[model samples]
Target: MTSHPTVGHVHLRVADLDRAIAFYRDILGFDVTQQSATAAFLGAGGYHHHIGLNTWDSLNASPPPAGHTGLYHSAFLYPDRASLGTVLCRVAAAGITLDGAADHGVSEAVYLRDPDGNGVELYRDKPQAEWPRNPDGKLAMINARLDVQAIMDEAP
Candidate 1:
């Protein structure tokens, strides 16, 4: 296989395109790069699009029923802890409640649902030098409650 490839984009089927746009654009701060009556594309650092939203097939449709096999979640990686914390503050200000937050040894993540009930994860990875490893040089990851308040304190 070739070298590892980065995730390109995530497309979601939303019920209300407008509401979904509000979440990704206003709340999460992605730029609305393109939009149509039933579809939209959003980007962060000026790439074409990092996220795409569409109501073509799912317009007004209810979220997928629970207890079914579907996407676990889409993870958005921030550049640093402070940047991640800044978004956490935005999430709180918008009254979007998080489902959970955790420190996974090599990363810190916050989980929540989108307007259409699609799971989302906002996170930042620790430097590789700080990653936990066993004596044999294997990864040693842990799931622990994250200090959300402390993280928020670093918000810009």
Candidate 2:
């Protein structure tokens, strides 16, 4: 047997390419490394692009109806709580309304919608050495209230 595997970029069809680019680049700090009049690609850590945005198909299209089995959300993982705070602050400064925030036992996250109502999640993982686990050593993940104020305090 031969083995080679990898997960590549995630492409999204958004209603407005520029708006999506602004949300991902300006608010989320993803570098817009490539773009055309109708398409844009963004990334972090010098990779080609982690996200590709284009309006080839969904231009002016309404968001997917709720209760559907499509993408729930796409999460951008930050390296640390401080960096997550940076994103939270950016979201605040951008006047974006937050839909929800939570501590998922192993990670802290903030949720909000882009201009086209697509869900975006910004999160930070807790150190694995300190993650909560069961007696059998399995992760004990659950949705819990995240300390938004405390996370903000970590900023600057």
Could you say which candidate leads in TM-score? 1
TM-score of each: 0.96, 0.92
Name model 1 segments beyond 4 Å from true.
Answer: none
Give each model's whole-structure lDDT. Answer: 0.93, 0.88
Query: What is the Cα-based lDDT of residue 33 in candidate 1?
Result: 97
Residue 6 CA error for candidate 1 (Å)?
2.2
Cand. 2 Cα-lDDT: 0.88
Model 2 lDDT at residue 73: 81
**Best model number under lDDT:** 1
For every model in order, what is the number of clashing pairs?
Answer: 0, 0
lDDT of 1 by residue, 1-156 (tens): 679878899999999999999999887779999999999999999999999999989999999999998888999989998998888999999999999999999999999999999999999999999999999999999999999989889988
Clash pairs (backbone) in predicted model 1? none
